[model samples]
Target: MSIAIIGPAEIEAMIDREVADYPTDTRAGAQTLEAFQNARRKPRLVSVNFSGGITQKCYSVTRPNGDYRVIYLPLAGYFSLCVESDFGPLDIGVHGPAIACFGSV
Candidate 1:
């Protein structure tokens, strides 16, 4: 099956909820929200789909409405999103801390 399409409103709502409720109110929350929103505003070079099991970070990963993935869990202060392709993972949030360590790299 291919990925479904969701409207901008729904995506916005998801981001808002994530931003408002994310624990610790860390920088990740703000940046994550911005990244998602920024993604929507542009014409993506790739299209987000779930059929291939995260084909690419084309766009959002939703349950049924779209390819958007929502990680709403208790004590889950962070949202880890990884975009995978036929080759390998495209984007990994796990290395966030490690990347921050490189001062102005």
Candidate 2:
């Protein structure tokens, strides 16, 4: 699998437009980012990953700079994010919560 990366300019723009008001101390920013990743990392059966939903594909991930799972979604791209380090059980959330739908290539 190809490694995912965000260019410095892109990350800089995100920081500027998204967290620009924050203080110079990166501790707060890091904390905020960590919290978000922890909140999003929920293990679930993901097969045909939708644009923004869970699947049963069962991914294999290995990245230490940060543990991440690369999912190929219906949007025709991958979303790689840091693994969830939360101490509690995971809860999966899907856009179509009632019917249990799925899609593929």
**Strongest candidate by TM-score:** 1
Q: Against the true structure, what is each candidate's TM-score?
A: 0.31, 0.21
Question: TM-score for model 1?
Answer: 0.31
User: For residues 1-105, what per-residue lDDT tens digits would candidate 1 score against the true structure?
Assistant: 554554445544555664466444678656654454443332222433333455443332322113223221112222233344554334443322211211111
The TM-score that candidate 2 achieves is: 0.21
In candidate 2, which residue ranges exceed 4 Å CA deviation? 1-25, 42-75, 80-105
The Cα error of candidate 2 at residue 4, in Å, is 14
Candidate 1 regions with alpha-carbon error over 4 angstroms: 1-4, 25-45, 48-80, 83-105
Q: How far is 93's C-alpha from truth in model 2 (Å)?
A: 17
Model 2: per-residue Cα lDDT over 1-105, one tens digit each: 664554434433433443345433678556654443343322333443333444334322212224333232223222333233342111222222111111100
Model 2: which residue pairs collide?
45-55, 45-56, 46-55, 46-56, 46-57, 47-55, 47-56, 47-57
